[model samples]
Target: MFILKRQDVEISSIQHPKRKQNIPILTYQGQSFRLISVFSDHQQEEAKAFWRELTDHRGKACVLLEETDRFSIWGKVSLEQLRAEESSNSAVSTYTKACILVLQAVYIDVEDLLGGRQAGLFQKDITNLFEKLKFPQADSPKAVKHWLNVDPLSNSSVPAWEEHHLITLLQELYRLGKEYFGNTNFAQGVRDILQDMPANDQNQFIDWLNQSALGQLWQ
Candidate 1:
């Protein structure tokens, strides 16, 4: 939760470690592994330099993962041996992040996309999606509405949704287009949407799309 500790430094944030250290903790899965999050308030170029240097890593516990706006976020892991292999958690989460990015890019005004009648159905679909998934916030009406409340011109924070949650949403969005609007050109529509996105986001979304089930339509 605490992404940053102090100026360019981050503290560990996992449950109990074999050896007790001076930091807070939370249980992950059934196994508790200590983790840290490093943050940098640097521009893209400087952040890249910092990332290159930090990744030399050695015994350090932070790896650069993003370069956005005026900050870069790094996942700081407390590992005795810095492994070269990527974590599955990070890889899976990237899909959710990219999907969130696409949603943010489109920033739909439900009224514009679905109109009054179909908009209600779209809302019902979202409610049902969360309820069926049994997400912690499934019962929260605001949580269901959160997905629809996007700002077209703003870069919003992404919800901490898992891969399944995002994939299902993408499927639902596709379904809504097909069923309600008769917009069968799903992949081309995505391509057109990306034409307006930032270069980095477009590339990231493309990578996710290429691997996603929905992207198969046009590819």
Candidate 2:
């Protein structure tokens, strides 16, 4: 089960009294979504209230929650439900670029092996990994899994992006959050902190452990 409040970005998993962490919630930008593991069903009152809140905002906003699992992402619900109004050349170009950039990010991680002795051995895997997707050329699942194994900072395969282009894309994402949910800012501070990260030394590991938000995401 899940609930969404567009006014904020939030996502949460529902909890039972017996659960270790009793907070039955995942909230993203003040919007809350929940996954119910113990309760096999929704209470009538809870359902009614949730339905009412959503219906009241009908055309104004949207939310999506899987009935079996509590998972949610803002604006995705409405966007998926509603067909895009019009198709434009610029929109097509934007989609293609996003697809290409994401794929490039994946490819850079392995491109170093392209001319090496390992190339023949991994060729099939690489081909399959880059196979086309509904979202055009997206990173293959295999590549993404490999990305998960990599330490973002340690990996020497970071993708190249024009400084202006990278900043523009990031800024666009930031503005989307601000315009819709009023987050105002996202990732900027994190990026700044990352830029200031000290070189690996005796204290590097501990300092990184303390400063990193990526590590906290799993928890």
Candidate 3:
């Protein structure tokens, strides 16, 4: 059976749904989307597994979103060219996911470094990172979660990616770390996550970071 893919989310609380509620809206790349689908929970799981197989064998575009539960939502995304070409979109999305993984890793690293202080500065830099990455209005973690249809710290899904995108993200992250918490604290955070990162590409990613415009910091 065919079913749509959706990412799971957890929320503290949500306003009760209106008897006639508007569709949940996700704004991405300057476009507004609210994908709707209906299938049994079992079928949903099967659908996700199918997507994983497709991603491993042949990349595809992000074209669906579904409501999983209260305060828990599902979403997906992909850059379908101005005219939607499968081959090119597939290649681009593959790399896009790698870049997103980099984004997720850095977010976790920096958040751990801050240790829950400086909400304003943290939000500011995160917002800047989203803007710098040119992802539209993902000016906060929540926004990022919504746009990517997954959380940064979560491992369920990834968007299109590229090596340069990873470099830009890390380089900017390094700058922000230094500017906000000093070289010592920022580098300390990098050291903390070196054992694993960017998924299995940790060593290569670290090497790329060390060679990036910012140069190696933790090492």
Q: Per-residue lDDT of 51-83 in model 2, one digit per residue for the tens?
A: 443345333243433344322222323222223
Q: Rank the models by lDDT, top first.
A: 1, 3, 2
RMSD to the true structure for each prediction, in A, is 15.4, 17.9, 16.8
lDDT for each residue of candidate 3 in 1-219, tens digit (9 for 90 to 100): 122324422212222132121234445444433322222333456335434433444353333334453111123332332224334444444344444554455555556666546534565666766764454345467776553335433444443333334444554555565666665454444434443335445555444445422344444
RMSD of 3: 16.8
Q: By TM-score, is 2 or 3 better?
A: 3
User: How displaced is residue 81 in candidate 2, in Å?
Assistant: 10
TM-score of each: 0.48, 0.25, 0.40
| lDDT score, candidate 2, position 208 | 30
TM-score of 3: 0.40
Q: What C-alpha lDDT does candidate 2 achieve relative to the native structure?
A: 0.33
Model 1 Cα lDDT, one tens digit per residue, 92-131? 4445555553543333544566577767666777576567
Provide the overall lDDT of each model, using Cα atoms, as 2-decimal numbers. Answer: 0.46, 0.33, 0.43
- Native RMSD of candidate 1 (Å): 15.4
- Clashing residue pairs in candidate 1 are 15-26
- List the lowest-lDDT window of 10 residues for candidate 3: 10-19
Better of 1 and 3 by TM-score: 1
